[model samples]
Target: MHFSSETRRDDGVVERDFTIGEIPGVLWTPEAAPTPVPLVLLGHPGGLRTMRPRLAARARSATRDGLAAATIELPGSGERPRGAKVDAVRAELRQALQTGEPVTPEIVDRLVLPLVEQAVPEWQTCLDALLELPEIGGPVGLSGGVISIGVRLAVVEPRIAAAVLFAGSFVPRVVLEEARRVTVPVHVLLQWDDEGNDRQVALDLFDALGSPEKSLYANLGGHTGVPAFAGEEAARFLARHLR
Candidate 1:
């Protein structure tokens, strides 16, 4: 909950760097909002520093839409300590990717399970801290990836009113099972041609989601080539729920 720096962007979004214990995070709010505003929790695949520009852009979009946005670094990513064991698993996954080796279920289990277990609680903790701020007092919505962590949060975090999930990440089968417990409205964005993602897994996971209001948006592109209209639709989805 301690902010290290604050900067007001040209577009009138106020950005702040913060830390809750060991987890580093960022929060963005409308520069002139007077009342409490809805909050959007921006999730990413980790590496907060590397991801900040894109994260901030999303935050600015939220603020422009009269919502607040925030994100925390996931376990074993960014500046936090990952220890030897987690580092070893990360190394294994990277090596497999570089060699064009199929990422086995075992390797995915090793790489993703620990992250879902640890990051979900950290997000909840960050939410607890962010809500204490006077400027952010409305409903919470989670928007972004890793899809596994988003699924867990949608299931367990009662405070989250909605979620906008980006498909095409390493989702373990266990998480797909957990998705059935998620009853809140969910909008999933799937990139049909993402080179690094498994299309079948994304489709299966989308089908596994138990939300009666869920919608899957499959676009033709690589990981970073999401069409602009796709993002606008996801924003609209959040606006509908949080409002």
Candidate 2:
């Protein structure tokens, strides 16, 4: 859906607009509440994409669970216009490849990493905006497409209550080890398929997690299907924890 000017549910949850750096975001919450409601910030996967259905489903579920939920259209998604700068980056990557020269780590770090870095602060700034709401609580939960990097960014802010990582991968072992410092609970959902990462390996890795309340849920299908389970489990988990 195109961004609304201001939207509200019959139950009194209001949807408001926010801007994180250059990125645009939206937050939803009940108009009347005794305290700040718990929140879940839904994040999109790597591709240039939008998952409005998934986000809407989560928002509805969170509303029922006495929590607030917000969905952000990441840097490249939604109505925001992309500029010539991005084209230049792509052109450089193309030129390097066309010349048969190896793409060095420095090139990737300098060019590609900045785009991803730009996205991280938008998520954090969205969380910052959500926290500003009168009905939102101190800690928030996240379910993102890029789990490893997402977790790194989320943990930077201690206010995050927990995180539900959906089929996340590409975790640096050093970073994964350091993630144990995150005090909040994390529920990692994984899919078992030859096309996907080895589900068992991912499960075992999370099973060894240092967080006190870490858990794992495994099922059939690819990256997208496992979130169906995360959707159900997230509702229950939020009720038990956030409530």
Those runs of model 2 whose alpha carbons end farther than 4 Å from true positions after fitting are 1-4, 10-12, 46-49, 78-116, 172-174, 194-201, 204-208, 227-230
Q: Which 10 consecutive residues of model 1 have the lowest summed lDDT?
A: 168-177
**Candidate 1 per-residue C-alpha lDDT over 11-89 given as tens digits, one digit per residue, 9 for 90 to 100:** 9888899999989999999989889999999999889999988998788778878999999998888888876877898
Segments of candidate 1 deviating more than 4 angstroms: none
State the TM-score for model 1.
0.96
Error of 2 at 86 (Å): 7.6
Residue 152, candidate 2: Cα error in Å is 0.7
- List, residue by residue over 207-236, the lDDT tens digit for candidate 2: 646679877776767666755655788667
Candidate number of the best lDDT:
1
